[model samples]
Target: MNWLNLEHLLLDESPDRLLCQDPDLTLGQLRRQALCAAAGLQARGIRHLAIHLEDAGELAIALLAAWRAGVSVLLPADLQAETRERWNPQVDLWLSEQPGDTRLGQLYDAEPLPAARLDLDQCSLSLCTSGSSGEPKRIDKRLRQLDNEVRGLEQLWGAELGNACMIGSVAAQHIYGLLFRVLWPLCAGRQWVRRQLPFPEDLQRASLDYPAFAWVASPALLKRMGDNLDWPALSKVRRVFSSGGALPADAALSLQQRLGQWPCEIFGSSETGGIAWRQGETLWQAFAGVQLTQDAEGALQVCSPYLAPGHAEQTADAARFEADGRFELLGRLDRIVKLEEKRISLPSLEQALVNHAWISEARLGVVRENRAYLGALVVLSESGLHALRNLGRRALTETLRKHLSNHCEALALPRRWRLLRQLPLSDQGKLPQALVETLLAAPRGKAPEVLEHKVQDDGLQIELQVPPDLACFTGHFPRTPVLPGVTQVDWALELGQRLLELPPRFAGMEVLKFQQLVRPGDRLTLTLRFDAARSKLHFAYHNQHQAPCSSGRIVLQDSATETAHA
Candidate 1:
């Protein structure tokens, strides 16, 4: 079947066309539901609606109805309670599956389901930014722009897709997933799963059910899927699409080896729709109608048909172009910082670090002491982890420094580095700058260098490294500085309340004991157990050698009012 343009998605499609996952569902039924909701929205005069639905089928009907009603829609990154409150002022009402919502069936009042072609130019959609650079902000687009993007995608991959089902791990609220997971299949007259697969195991099972399918994935998920599952289950897949960020070279290679083809890596953002794509190569070929150029400092400027007319985007990403009209991506140009009066490119440095065999993922952040310097948070590969376990911290740090020095000038090297199991990405799969800065600090009012944080059903166990540069150590006995007992107690309460949902206010402490001197670079383990019935927290700290350093039990209160009496 030829692609039915979104403008005529309802008008042109046959009544019996399959809509989605439900075998009995038909285009006619979906059209009637959308029309009823459209009538309801018009009756209420809803200008804007913020919506979150767990079922993508209902979500699709809602989107169609809202657009037909000429109501703009806001899609939050998640259905979290805080997300709703934060975005409350921007919308008139929320159409959600959460508690206290009216029946979705109630809106299906239009029985005959009036037929009409979409005036896509008038329809608008708003989605959240991916939350990588900072807090996720709202990015608005006309329905026509989205229509154009999907049409472009269809032109590129429709033949290869050939009626395959759409199934994915990514959320539909973000732009990448919205286009590839939902809109593309809907506009192209293809079927899609009503819900996203939560894990690779789920993907494996789902793939076996569909005759032909496509997998929309994230780099983080692909990296984590390494060799543990039944790879043969995905042999029938037609295509795999990756976005949100670059798929690292090694991870991409690993996937190619397992899946028999490299994923079609998409490069774009919420602001810039589909710009270019690459597969098994470093260079990205621009989309059919996208014009790419560079700024004075090499930042990429895009004239993509995906945007509104006259909206040429100047992105922060740096790029290098070849004579053949293909371009290679350098990292973000916006992360330039001045360290000791020397300008350092954090992205460039991070790229250098990630290319090393020792690191799988690298994020560079600023650390402030008396002066500001660069610090790093990295995920080590199997080989790097092996080296760390055998040669210890000093040797690992030294080897990393030697590798980094080969790519950058001496002034651009990171002063401190911490290896982690993974990157600190949000639910939207973005790295928040504020979160990065928090991870790089061991300041006066914060917990010391966190080596490990493990969460279990009843409690949390934290591993800490006492840094020599900790602000509290300045005067605590400059010559013979030891970790303050007060700081240790506070950290226990802090970590306990976060991971265990302990009472909010401090009551008192008991059985406090200090058995060891915790000096610079000392490793300590803090284990916390919460007794919910009594509102009591028991904390134990142990040195690296598994000997007791500090032990205590702290009382907690539900509120400040209760604490005052205590």
Candidate 2:
């Protein structure tokens, strides 16, 4: 496919394509700088160069120059010694404008420069996968794939993204960020914000700066924004797109509530780009020209001319088809398990638990001692705790049991329960399976001061300490080792349970708050009190310095009929 030249394609529009943050690079300046860079690289005989850069303007220029020169380019994942070593032997050049340009210059000084020859069908770029499961894999792309992708996005986004200022919180090194924020905007003549990585504050700032800003980010960024209690009331954001990880249904609703009613959530992977998008919780219609095919095993398969030909890629996610060519996201195929001779999806159970008023987050996993039994770790809110304490532990567990009984059988009610103020989520907004196992392995006797027992007429008090020797501190940070919030919340609940022993069970928790970081060597105090007759549990937490940290309420179950009911 012969395409328009990069310089002509971009410069033909107008001299004034206003990027929100960057005042330095105008359309004309960008084109000139890219041509110069391309000429320089070609003169140095750097045909196959790999880039590890963060500057949006610089990357755009470099990529455009490489395309114009018909030289191959690779965008590796954020640099590591190992990645450098792997690409070093294979790459003829390393193109970067960082401080260490001289280092690369010294490596390849002898080779003769090549003439600049632009071609449409040449290998354009390669993007590395996220490497969540293993080593990062490289996916090569022709100019055609990118041309089709940008065209598809331009059409699919319609007016929502049309002429909207693209603001991205994710790094440009990744596929999702590169395609939606950089390449699509470049090819489709859309203006974009220059910031490559944006924090919650930066995102809000970008929205305020560019009244027409549309955020393109991953679910991890979205969850972080929601979990950050101090986030400003966002008003200027036009729309937000989420991918990279599964967008939690609750998270989508929360974003819509926080940022004015904006359509959000685009569902896709790096392999297929954006396959479909969800406005709210309801329906997900496939993007234009994307076709869904069911495999022999009843699993969903995809075939789109946008993807490479002669290959059928299967996905682990299952979907329920609707009459209008839309689909509902069912939990992953691997998440389904047989519990008590009944099929159960752990994700479905986890979602149901979090739906409770008292519970802020929950995780359900099947444990096998002699036979498999449902296990749960729950984090409660302040109001949830009050309701649980008022009704008493017996009544609280009974209510929860009956609530879960609607979807799951009697045997599916979690036999073993550990109360927590928050559940651990990975950097990608996924629950860590390995961390769950570690929490479950804690011995019953030494459940720590956090998880023991406390009873008081006025209220109960508890203390939690992040021991420096804990194994988790190592992985959290090698040098500046600290306690992760995941472990902090776990200790908070263990202490909460010890302080307020109620009927051997509790309704759950409510309004549980995490105000700040609790690192190793920081001692935290948990204080609790309750209306015994009314079964109300009120609690407060303070650090070793007596600095007030967080406080909440718990609903306790009355002992009268707790176990018998369960």
Identify the leading candidate in terms of lDDT. 1
**CA-lDDT, candidates in order:** 0.80, 0.64
Question: What are the RMSDs of all candidates, in order?
Answer: 6.9, 13.4
Error of 2 at 111 (Å): 16
Error of 2 at 517 (Å): 19
Clashing residue pairs in candidate 1 are none
Candidate 1 segments exceeding 4 Å error: 22-24, 79-86, 100-103, 109-113, 442-566
Error of 2 at 74 (Å): 2.9
TM value for model 1: 0.78
Tens digit of per-residue lDDT, candidate 1, span 1-566: 45677888667468777868654567777888888898888777778888777666777788888888888999988777778788888888788777775446667765434768888889899988756686668888998899989989998999999989888788787788788877888877788888777577777877787888998888767767757687877767899888877687888898888889888999998899988999999999999999998899999999988998988999999999999999998888878888778788888888888878878888998987887878888887767765654465567778888888987778677787766667756434568766787888843334577866998676888888765335565456545666789988988988887767877988799999999877655678889999888888999999989999998989988876585776
The stretch of ten residues in a row with the least summed lDDT in candidate 2 is 104-113
**Candidate 2 lDDT tens digits, 1-566:** 12233335434445556433465556665665566666667677778878766666667777776776567888887667788787777688766655654232233323322324345457478877655433567877776666667777766664565566788877777767787777777665566777654466667666665546678886767755755433344555556887666665666767777766644677776666667877875678888878897766556787765567655557767888988889987656666678767888877787787777866677777666788887777765555555543444345556677788887878888776655544555333446554565565553222233433355556655555444235564445644554565554445455545444554456777777766555544567766666667665666667777876666666667666676687
